[model samples]
Target: MSGIYPFLTPAGDAARDARESAARELVRSTAAKAVESLELRLRVLGTLGPALAACAAAMATAFRAGGTLFAFGNGGSSTDAQAVAQVFRTPDRDGGRPWPALPAISLTGDAALLTALANDVAFDVVFARQLAALGRPGDVAMALSTSGGAVNVLRGLEQARRTGMVTVGFAGSGGGRMAEERLADHLFVVPSSSVHRVQEAQTTACHVLRELVRAEPAEA
Candidate 1:
């Protein structure tokens, strides 16, 4: 078959021919996947407007009231939770910014606390336990779950609700149990199969949520 290496082959000659061909093929395959991932993210952007705005309102209310933000998720979603919290806590603005540092905490940030909950009680209650301890009315609870149906994620949301904190969720296609159960007050679901794309859109949605918090409410 024809290939991109034909015009200028590596100097190693036959010894590197097989390796070079394999590398070229890998690049092509990865590039195609990247294109698909970008497309999926674009498809989900439309669904985020309302959900993100609603979430922002909740977050802004928390900020205005001196309430803290508690964020959590499982696995890769865990990382997104951390990223979202950091983004909010670290704001951007003109003249070095005027808003005070928001108090945003990630449930996954405390290793000892998580291990203790997982060891003593149950993995499902890890986030629930923390919320029970640190959360109060007026706080915001943000959870990231690609599938949105993770048992642990559900438990966390349930606990957040009981604690009177606003619940926000970011999920992939179908919205999983998050949508089914209507656990989150503000739930955004990406209409895509690729986990990467869902997360990419989710990250953008998160930043937008922060922006809305800083933005003046629309005149109505």
Candidate 2:
């Protein structure tokens, strides 16, 4: 009688085992990279303190001078863009105060407008079209892209810049084309190649920016 193994193995047991082990090692390595990426983001946050303070000051100034905030993103990033807009539009529950005078719009929110723009013009014109219609000097355009090279995002940034709006880009992977083009007035780049990791950092950055804006003194 042959001894029975509890589990059945593939015909190429040794090769299968080796491949499985290699896969596990790869997973572990990727996990470690993700963790390191997060740690790097925390470290970068420390350096952002002074710059964020300056951004808050600048935002306050912009608001005082009567400006709005416009945000745009694609796919998952569109959700983040809307979330950021909500943070500005809604009242802060902890503070019990609302930023009533400050206008916050997400270019990705209106499905009808987006469809019309994409159909009538082009997909790349969606955000740019909205910016052209709504953006103004002293306003802020916050664009998010994990790859940092989305043509539509770049177009929106260009439109915002041309209209004199402050162009802010949140991106990943060395900031891609945006970094090359130097299109944004302020750019936050998440130093990770993994899409998941970059998106996580982008969400965190948006939350931080929202908090900074909320903490600022309301317009008198």
Candidate 3:
């Protein structure tokens, strides 16, 4: 059996052991990176306590005034935008008191409209056009951008501001043009160049903002 099976030989066994050791090391290194990223997110979120609270209060006020929330983004951020809308539209009931389902719409959800605008006009105007059509004063506009320089995202924020909506921005890489121009009424920057880590931190921020908004007492 030893002669027929390569794994029964000493050389084969050594090779197998080397492969297993490499795999273990790879897993260890990857897991360590993930842990480091998670710690970064939690630490940053802790440091942003006051800003988060203020942003939440603003959002809660908008909701109380019957304002709708419009969330938009591109690529992975688009998915995050949808997640943001879903979180507000159907809040989690796992906690002490269930949150009310707030009105939220994802600008990236309508493929037909997005394509129509992109094809007919310009890609940069897709979100801006949507806001012009639907957004109102006192409404909330939330946008996410990893580099914070997406043209369409910037345009959307501009439109929101022009329409008197409360603009909220989730951005990474030192907030890029979004912070430079002071576009958002409330801007949360993750301070990371890595897209994955930035998105993860943004997701945490979104959940925290939702909780804080829900905690605010609604007007009688």
Candidate 4:
């Protein structure tokens, strides 16, 4: 059969031929997945106008009131949580807008605290207990869960609600329990089952959210 490696003559090494074929397939699949992920990100962002605006408005209000933001998640979502906190705490300077840093915290940042909470208490209460101690009225709770269904994440949202904090969620796969329970005041669900695509969309959503919040006509 014809192939990209034309130099792989019919009599060439069989192992090298197999490797080239695998490499070609890998390149093709990776490009396809990358394009798919980008498409999903755009689609999600396009549909996020209303919800994103509402979330940004609420967050801006909270910030105006001197409220802090608390973010949490699990596994890769935990990394996303940290990214969210960082993006808010340190506005990108590349925009040349000279935006002020916002108040944000990642609940997963403190390994000691998380481990202590998990070990001393149940894993589900890690965020809950922290919220109980640190969260206050008018604060914001942002939880990231590709599946929309981490028990600890759900508990954190519940705690945020009980404490009068604005709740936001980045979830995927039909919004899972977070949607069913109506935990977040603003929930953005990327209806895909692929975790990578969901996360890519969520990251874009977060950046857009920051832009919206900054665009709000409120005194800093």
Candidate 5:
């Protein structure tokens, strides 16, 4: 059989090679951007050590006083809120010794309440209304927002403050309005613009805080 057909011209072969190189470079650039984003998140987490420590201390104090934890967020952040609640509510066992106690509630878990509030009052009142009904002094309210500007989360924080709950906010990109408005007693800011990076850092922060609370001795 005849040899495989060659390019019609030298220029054609060169053009094809250039296009392939460009495609490869594009892939590489995209991968590099993703890696860089993760690296930035790691750096933000490292920088948040002190803030996380403070949050842990506050949580420890609250738990010791028999205070519950209330969490709220929007969209993906709502999942994070539920995760935080579960982390605290579930007992961690290593060998025979059980970890310290953590009682947490995610405001987003009740679909009935959410739908009722959203339909009757407004979306922004879902969490706030719950806080008014269920929260008590000495409890803690943990709010999550990728943009740190979700109106519903803000309303929850407002209600938390009025009810004397300790307010904690997980926020990204300079903590947005939460940072500026001083809405949180402890605000953990992940300093990235990408939602994925912020979310990863937020998860890490929550786990760290939970572990810290778990490390403390149970109240007498």
Candidate 6:
């Protein structure tokens, strides 16, 4: 029986051992990368200075005035926009002052409307058209773009500005045209070239801004 079973063979276990080793190495590498990205974001936070403060103030102003926040983006940025809306709408319910839920809408939430805008007009106007229809003066628009070169994201911010809404863009990799043209009232560029790093950092910034807005009254 031992011979037939190859003596509970060490050779049979080679594949499993190698696979486990590879998996462990991958986990270590990924964790290291995540920590590196987080460290970079922390450095950014320390030096962001008045720009971050201004963004917080603007967010607070919109909230105090009973204005809504509209977030829009494309691809991964679209998901980021939705996530920002979620955080504003749903707090953690942890031990803290129960704050009022801020109103935030993700423009990329509706597929039918997006498709219609793309098919009827231009693809670049998908977000711009939505902003024109739903946005009003005093509203805040948060535009997310990892590269910051996405035409639709820029167009959306431009339209929001034209519609008299305060525009804010979260971008990365030198902030592309959003940084170049100063299209938004506030623009934040995550200090990383990797899309994943930029995305994670932007989420942190958004959450921090939300907290500042909630605490603005006490500051004043």
Score every model by TM-score. 0.86, 0.79, 0.90, 0.92, 0.83, 0.88
Q: Please, what is the whole-model Cα lDDT of each candidate in the order they appear?
A: 0.83, 0.83, 0.92, 0.92, 0.87, 0.85
Q: Rate residue 74 of model 5 by lDDT.
A: 94
Clash-forming residue pairs, model 5? none
List the RMSD of every prediction in angstroms.
Answer: 4.6, 5.8, 4.9, 4.3, 6.5, 5.5
- Between prediction 1 and prediction 6, the one with superior TM-score is 6
lDDT of 1 by residue, 1-220 (tens): 2366453445567637776777788899999988887776666666567767767777777777888988899998999899878977885564765655688999999899899999999998999989999999989999898898998889989999998998888889899999999999988888877788888888877877777787744222
Could you tell which candidate, 2 or 4, scores higher by lDDT?
4
- The pairs that clash in candidate 1 are none
RMSD (CA, Å), candidate 6 to true, equals 5.5
lDDT of 6 by residue, 1-220 (tens): 2366443335557855765676688789999998898897897777675787888888788778888999988888899899889888775543677777789999999999999999999999999999999999999999999988999989999999899998999899899999998998888888789998988888888878887677677333
Each candidate's clash count: 0, 0, 0, 0, 0, 0
Off by over 4 Å in 1: 1-15, 95-97, 217-220
lDDT of 6: 0.85
TM-score of 3: 0.90
Q: Give residue 114's error in model 5 in angstroms.
A: 0.3
- Root mean square deviation (Cα) for candidate 5: 6.5
Q: Is candidate 1 or candidate 6 better by lDDT?
A: 6
lDDT of 5 by residue, 39-142 (tens): 87678668887888878888788888989999999999999999999989988786778874468999999999899999999998999999999999999999
lDDT of 5 at 133: 97
lDDT score for residue 43 of model 5: 86
Model 6 pairs in collision: none
lDDT of 4 by residue, 177-212 (tens): 999999999999998999999989999999999999
